[model samples]
Target: MASAVLYGPLFLQLPADLVLYLCREHLRPASAAALSLTCKSLFVLVFAGTRPGFNGGTQRRDLQLLLEKDLGHAPLPRRRVLLGSGFSIGYRSVRLAMNRHFLGAPNGLPLRYFDVQGISLGPLRWFEKWSARILQGELFLSARRTMCGSAWTDEALRAALDHEGPRYDICGHVSMSGPWSISNVTALHSAAVSASTSARAPVVLVPCRDLVEACGRCLTDYTTTVERRVRPVQGGGVDGRQTMEYWFITITSFHRLGSGRSPWDAKWQAFGGRPSISTIRLRRDMETHPPGAVKAAWDEGEQAAVSGHRRSHSSPTWRAC
Candidate 1:
C-alpha cells in the first residue's frame, strides 16, 4: 500500500531516466548516497545495475573507461578491500587536494609522472623539530614586522609579536640502527649510487646543515668525481643577524652505456650526462611572510628559476662557461 502511494502519479511525473541522469550529473557523491537511501525505488534505480562486472553493455563500458581515466583505477572489490564505503570518491578527492597543495595546479593533475626516490632523516621527526623552533617566539617579531609593515608598529601587532619562548623537555640521543644517518656523507653518496643503478629515476638527498657543510668540505675528496653548484641568498634571521645560506644538492640519473661500469664509475657518470640539476636555496626570513604566502612565493620562484636554468643550460653539463 505504501509502495503504491509513493510510486503513484507523483513519482511517475518525472521519468526514471531523467531522475537518474540528474543524480549522476548534478549531485555530489554524498548527496547521491542520501537520495538512494530515501526509498527502495531510488536505490534500485541508481546502484542495482552498477555492481562490479555487471555489464549494461555500451553504457557501462563507457562509464568504466571515464572512471579509470579520472581516478587512475577502479575501486577494489568490497570483500577484498579494507576501505569503507565511498572509497573511490574519497580517494579521488584526497588525491586532488594533495596535488593542489603540493604542486599548485588548479586541476590537480600532474604534467608528468616519474618514480622519484628520496632519502631523508625521518620527515615526521624533522617536522616536529621545525614546529618546536617556530613556537619559540624568537621569529615572531620579525614575522610581524615583515608581513604587517607599518602596522607592526601599532600596539596590536606589537602585542601579538611580543612573547617569551616556551620551554620543553629535550629527549636524549639514542644511537639506534638506521639505514643512513644525515651526518655521514659517505653513506649519503653510497645510497645515491645504489638508487641510480637500481632505478632510472632521479635520486634526491635531503640532509641537515651540518651534513650539507660536511659534503661541501669533502666534495673533492670523494673517490668518484662529483659536480657541485652553489646558489646563495641573503635574508634576516630571528636573532637580527643577516645571514647568507646556500643549497647543496646532488642529483643522480642513469644513462645507457655500451658496457656496465663498476659502482664507482657509475656514480661519477651519473652526474655527467644530466643537462641541468634542479636545486632550491630558501631565504631564512621566509617566516616573515603571511601564512601560506611564503610557501606559494617560494614554489613559484623555485619553478621559475629551475625552468630558466634548464633553458640556459641545455647542453650536456651544467658548468658555467
Candidate 2:
C-alpha cells in the first residue's frame, strides 16, 4: 500500500514507448533491485529486458531476474596455505566485483534488501526470506600434518574434515614419532621437570575461538603437524635408575587452508592452483593458550640427545592462517 501511495497511479500510467527514454541506463545490480520495489509497474520496467519471455508478471519472474547478476565477493585476498604445504603454483582465480551481496552485508544488513532512498524498509514479515539468502553455503576449513611436504589440495582436506563428523564437532589426534622411550604425545605444561609422570597428560587443544565462535562461520575442520624434532624437555635428577630422560612436545601451532577467501581478494586454491605471489613465507605466529588441567610432566635421567639426534628447542615455523 505504501508503494502504491509512493508511486501512485499517475506514474504507472506512463506510455510503454516513453519508458525506455525515462528509465536510467546501466543501473547497478543493487540499485536496480531497489528501483524495482517502487511498485509492480517499476519492477517490470527495470527487469523487462533481462529474460527472453519475462512477461513482467508474477513475483516469481521478478526473483529469477534479480539472481542473474553476481553479488558479494572479496576485493583483495591473502593467499591461503594448507599448513605444511606451499602455495599452488598455477591456478585460475577471479574476484567478484563487490563484497556485500551474499554472506553478511555492510551495516549487517540482510541479503536482497530492496528499499527506496528515503522510503521505509518494507514489512517485517519478509525477514525470513532475506535471512535464507545470506550465506553462500558453507566454507570448509581443515588442518593436517604431513610426513615431509604436504601439498594436499583443498578438496581432499575438505572431504577429510567432513568425514570426521558433522560440522563443528571435529576432534583429531596427532601422534609423535621419536625414540621408544618417549613416543607418546604429551600436552605442554608449565610444571617443572620434577613433576611426576605417573599419569599421562592429556594434550588438550585450547581453541582459539570457543565452540560457539569457531562454529559460527561454518569454518571448522581438523589437520595436524608432526613436531618430530620439537621435544620440550628439561633435565631432572636420575629417577628409578633411569639412564636417560625422554619427553613429548606439545602441539603449539595450528593452521588451515582451502575453500575460502582471504582478507584480500585471493581465493583459497587447491594444490597446483593459483598463487598471489610467487615468493612465499610461513612466519610463525606464536599463539599461546591457557594451561590445560593435565599437569606438566617429563621423563628423567636422559642424555641431551635422544637416539643420537639432538632435540630442537625451536617451535615449528609453520604459518598461522
Candidate 3:
C-alpha cells in the first residue's frame, strides 16, 4: 500500500525516464538492475548518463588537505628517487584525491597517494592496459606517467617490453640506472647492434659531454662498465683520452644507425635529417657518422693526415717549390 502511493505520484508527475533514473541511482544496488528492467527509460539514464558531478572540483585534492582540514598541518611531499646530480624522480601525493574523484566518492579523505622510490609493476601494467583499452581516453597519460620510474630491474623491464598488448618502451629509462655504463663496451656494443637489428629499436638518449674525459670516469666506474668495454674496441690503439673520445663518437654513430638512417651518409647530411640541436658540432665532418660511414671516412682522413704529417716532417730539408 505504501509502495503504491510512492510509485503512483512518480507515474503522474515525472517522466518515465526520470522516474526510472531516480530509482536506479537511489535504489539498493541489487534492486537497481531490476528497476531498470521494469522500464528502458531508467536503464539508459542510469547506465549511459554522464558521470554525476561531485560538488566542486576540489573533491579530489589528495590527502594533504584531509589532514589539514580534519587533522592538522602535515609534512610536504618528499623526494623519493634521487638520481645524482641535478636529476631526481619523485611521486605525486595528490593522486589519492584524483582517484577518489574518479570514483565519485566524497572528497577530502586522507588516502595513500604517493609511493616514493617504489616501482610498482602491477599499477604500471594496469595503466598501460587501460590506456590502450580506452584509446585516447582520459587517464591515459596519468597511467603512463605513474608507470615511469628511474630504478628498474632488467628482468622486470624485459617483461614490460615483452608485453605486446601495449608498449611504453621502458628501455630508455632502464639504460639510465646506475648500471649499464659504457665500461662493458662489448656488451654495450652488442646491445646497440641488436637494437639496430630489431624492427623497432629503442632510442638511447645520452647526455652530451666531452668524449675522452667522460669515458675516464665511465671506464673506472662499475656502473659505467659497459662504456669502458665498448670504447676500447671501437677506439683502437689511441691514448686513454683519445680512446674515450673515439668511443663516445662510436656510440653516437651506433645510435644514429638504429634510428633508421643510412650508415653510409655523410655526417652533415645525416645531421640535417636527424633531430639534433644547434649547439652540437661534429669535430670532423663525419665523426658521428654511422659505423659504415665512420669507418670509410676514418680511412680517408687517416691517409690524408698521415701523409700531410710525413710531408711536413720531411719538408724541413727541402727547398721551397
Candidate 4:
C-alpha cells in the first residue's frame, strides 16, 4: 500500500525511455570513470541521507564510511592477496583532509583551518609534518583539477583526489591502486631502484616530451607522463651481465572552484565567497578537464571528449552561467 501510494502514477509516468537514454548516454564512459562515479555517488549518498526528517549527521558518517572503508583510501592488491582483504595499503582520508585544509585555507586561522606542523595544532601532528597530505595535496594537476579549493572533509577531499593524481596498477594488473601524484610515484620508484639489491624492472614516471605550456591563463594546466620501462636483452653484455634497453611508455588520463552567493552576482562562482551550491558545481566543473597528463604520455587512441565548462577566473571571460 505504501509503495503504491508513494511511487504512484507520477513515478510510473516518469518516462522510462528518457531515463534509459540518459543512463545509456552517461554510463557508457570508459575513462576516468572515477570522476563520473564521484559526482553520481556523492549525489546519491548525500541526497539519500539528507532527506527531510532523516538523521542529520548520517550523510557525513556515510561519506566518511565511503572514504575509510569502501575505497580503501589507497587500495593495493598485494595487501588483499597476501595480507587478506581490508588490509591497509594506506588510510588517507584524514591526511587528505588535512592537506586540503592547508591548501584551501586562503582566509583560515592558523590552527583552526590548518596546522600540519602543529605550530598551532599539536606537537605530534607537527612532528609528522603531515607527509600524507603533502603527497596527495598538490600534485596531479591538469586543466580539470586546480591547485587549491576550500573544501576538506572526507568526501570532498576524496572527490578532489579522484580528479588529481594518476591511476596506477599493481601485481601485473591483478590489482589496482592510485589517484596518486606523479611526483610521489616517481620519487618512490627512484628510491626502490636505488635501494634494490637485485636487478628488478621498475616502472618509472618521467616526461616523455617537453611540457606543453598551455597554462590556459593559470586555470587549465597541462602535463605529460612517460613510464621508464627496462627490458633485458637475451644476449649478454660485455661483463656477462644482462644488457637492458630502456623504453618510455605512456599512460592515458581522462578526468575547480568557486563561489556564487547571489544567482546574479558576477563573482558568484569564484572561490572563498558567500557559499552557494553552484560553487560546488563550478568546482566540480573545473575538475573535469581530463585531469591527467597531456601530449607524449597520452598521445595514442585519440582524445576523450572534454565535458562541461568552467567560468574563467579572469575578468575578460568569466560570466554568469
Candidate 5:
C-alpha cells in the first residue's frame, strides 16, 4: 500500500458542492474563518460566496426564503453549540461570542455548549435566561494559559467585561493546558448535567481575574521566555504523546502560586454569595464520543432536540439564576 498522503481522497475527490454544504452545515464560525485562509479556492468558496443567493435590502428575508426552499419550512431554530478540541486556543472567543449573542439578542439565542476536556464552561445558563456577571482579574492569568503569545489589550478585555450583567449566565474555564492539573478528557467523563445544587439550573464557572493576578507567576515564567522548543515525547509514534513544554512550565509555576491561598478566596463577592471563583476547577466529563454525541446531561426535552427524535417548537434548555 502506498503510504503517501493522498489529496485525492482527502480533498480533490470530494465533490466541491458537497464540501461547501458540509462547511456551511457543520463547521463552527471560527472554523469557517480558518478554512477561509487556507488557499484561494477555499477562500472564494467559503468566504466570498458565503452570502450568495441573497441580494439587496431584504437580507434577513432573503435568507429565510433561501433556507426555506433548501432546508424546508420547519427549519430547526438556529441554536449555537460551541464545539472544539479542549479549548486550548480560539474556543474562548468563540464561546464568548456565543454568550454575547445569547445575551445581546434574547429573541434568537443559540444553545451554547463548550466541548473541551477537563474545562467546564460553567453552568448552562442559556436554559436559565440569566444575565452574566464579570469578575475582575489580572490580564495574564485571567485568560487561558494558552493565550501567552496573544496580544489582547487591557482595553479590549475591559470592554468585554463591561457589558456583562446578571441576566446572562457567564461561565469561563481554564483551557486544557493551564497550570491547573486536571485532565480535561477525564473530567468530561464524570461531569453530570443531571442537576446542580439548584434544580433545572445550568452550571457556569466564572474565572476571577483577581486570582489570575495573584497567579501571574504561572504566566510570566512560561510565556516570557524567548526560547521555544518542540513538545516533549515520552514514547513511540502511534501511542507517542507530545506535551508542550512551555505549558508544563506554566502549570508548575501556577501550582506554586496556589500553595497559600484556598480556592475559595477568589470569587465574585458582589453578588451576595456565589461560588468562589478559584473553587471552580477545570474538571468536567468531556470524553471523546463519536462525531455528534452529547456531553452535558440532557433532559427529555433537550435530548429530543439533540437526537433529532422530535420536531416541535420549544424554548432553549437554559434559564438564568
Candidate 6:
C-alpha cells in the first residue's frame, strides 16, 4: 500500500466558501476565536463577513434585518421586588430616558443624568406578555437577600457600585428581615454614595418595608441622613482647588395605602397589604452655596494644608431612631 500523504500547507488553500461554511456550521464563539489563529488564509475567510457568511453587501443587509427582527422579539429585562415578609410587590419593566437634568431639577447640570421616566408594574404574569421591549439601556440592578446580612456584601452589587462606565443608574431593591436600625440605614447611605462616586451616576433605592409600624420612621430617617451626607459643600480642597460637587441619590418610598396610588400600587394591593410610599424632596436651600464664600473657604483650606496641621472633617452626624 502506498504511504498516506499529508498536505500541510495545501490545507490552507481550501476554497473560501468551504472554509466559511465550516466556521459558520461548526464553530462556537470560543471555537471561532481559536480557529481565527490557525492560519492567515482561514482567518481571512472565516471573518470575511461581519457575522458568519455575511461577506457580501446583500448578505450583510439580510443578516442585519434578521438581527433586528430577533431583537424585536427579545424579552425586556425584568426585576422582581420582593418584600422581607415573603410578599412580592411585583416585577418592574424599567423605562429609562436621557434627561438634561436630574429628575425634577430646575436646570441641567454638567453631569449626565438618566431619568427613570416610568416603570411598568403589575402581576408577575403581565411582564411576560410585554417581553419584546428593551427596558434598560446600560443599567445595573442590585437585589438584597432577605435571609440575613447586608446587601453591600454581594459581589455583583459591589462591582456594580465600583463600575466606571458612562452614566448608568444603579437601581437597588433593599429588603430588611431583621429589626431596622440607624446603622442599617447608614450602611445603605454609604453604599449609595460610594456607588454614585464610582459610577458618576445617581442611585435610586427602593426599600421594601415589612414593619408597617416602622415604615414612616425608616423613610424619614433614611431620607434625612442621605440628604445631609450628600449635601453640597462650600469648601474643603487641597492647594486652593475647587471641590467637585458629588452626585445625589434619590430614595423612592411607596405609599402604604391612600387615595393616591403609585405605579406599584396595584401590585402591593394584590398582596393584600398596604405599602408605604413617600416623596421626600431634598431642600434646595442647602443645595447651593455663595460663590464668594465658597472661594474664601477653599482659600482658607489651602492655607491650612500649607501649614503643619491639616484639618479633618467629620462624617455627617445623624440621630438614631
Residue runs of model 6 more than 4 Å from their true location after superposition: 1-14, 17-68, 71-79, 82-183, 187-321
Residue runs of model 2 more than 4 Å from their true location after superposition: 1-42, 49-244, 250-265, 270-321
Model 4 residue 200 lDDT score = 64
Q: What is the lDDT of residue 213 in candidate 2?
A: 12
Task: Provide TM-scores for the models.
Answer: 0.19, 0.22, 0.20, 0.19, 0.19, 0.19
* Count of backbone collisions within predicted model 2: 17
- Model 6: what TM-score? 0.19
TM-score: model 3 vs. ground truth: 0.20
Per-residue lDDT of model 4, residues 35-125, tens digit only: 2245554334323454322235544444343333222233222211101111112113223333334545322112221222211121111
Cα RMSD to the true fold for all candidates: 22.5, 22.2, 24.5, 21.2, 25.1, 24.0
Candidate 6 lDDT at 93 equals 26
Clashing residue pairs in candidate 4, if any?
117-126, 144-289, 257-283, 258-270, 259-268, 259-269, 259-270, 260-268
Model 3 residue 44 CA deviation (Å) reads: 23
Q: Provide the global lDDT of candidate 2 against the true structure.
A: 0.28
Candidate 3 local lDDT, 95-194, one digit each (tens): 2223333443443223332221223233232222111011111111111122222233434443333332222222111222223332233322334445
Give the alpha carbon lDDT tens digit for every residue of 67-138 in model 5.
321211222333323222122222222223333343343322132332222332422111111111111211
Backbone clash count, each prediction separately? 0, 17, 16, 8, 41, 8
Model 2 quality (TM-score): 0.22
lDDT of each: 0.30, 0.28, 0.30, 0.29, 0.29, 0.30
Point out the higher-scoring one by lDDT: 2 or 5: 5
Best by TM-score: 2
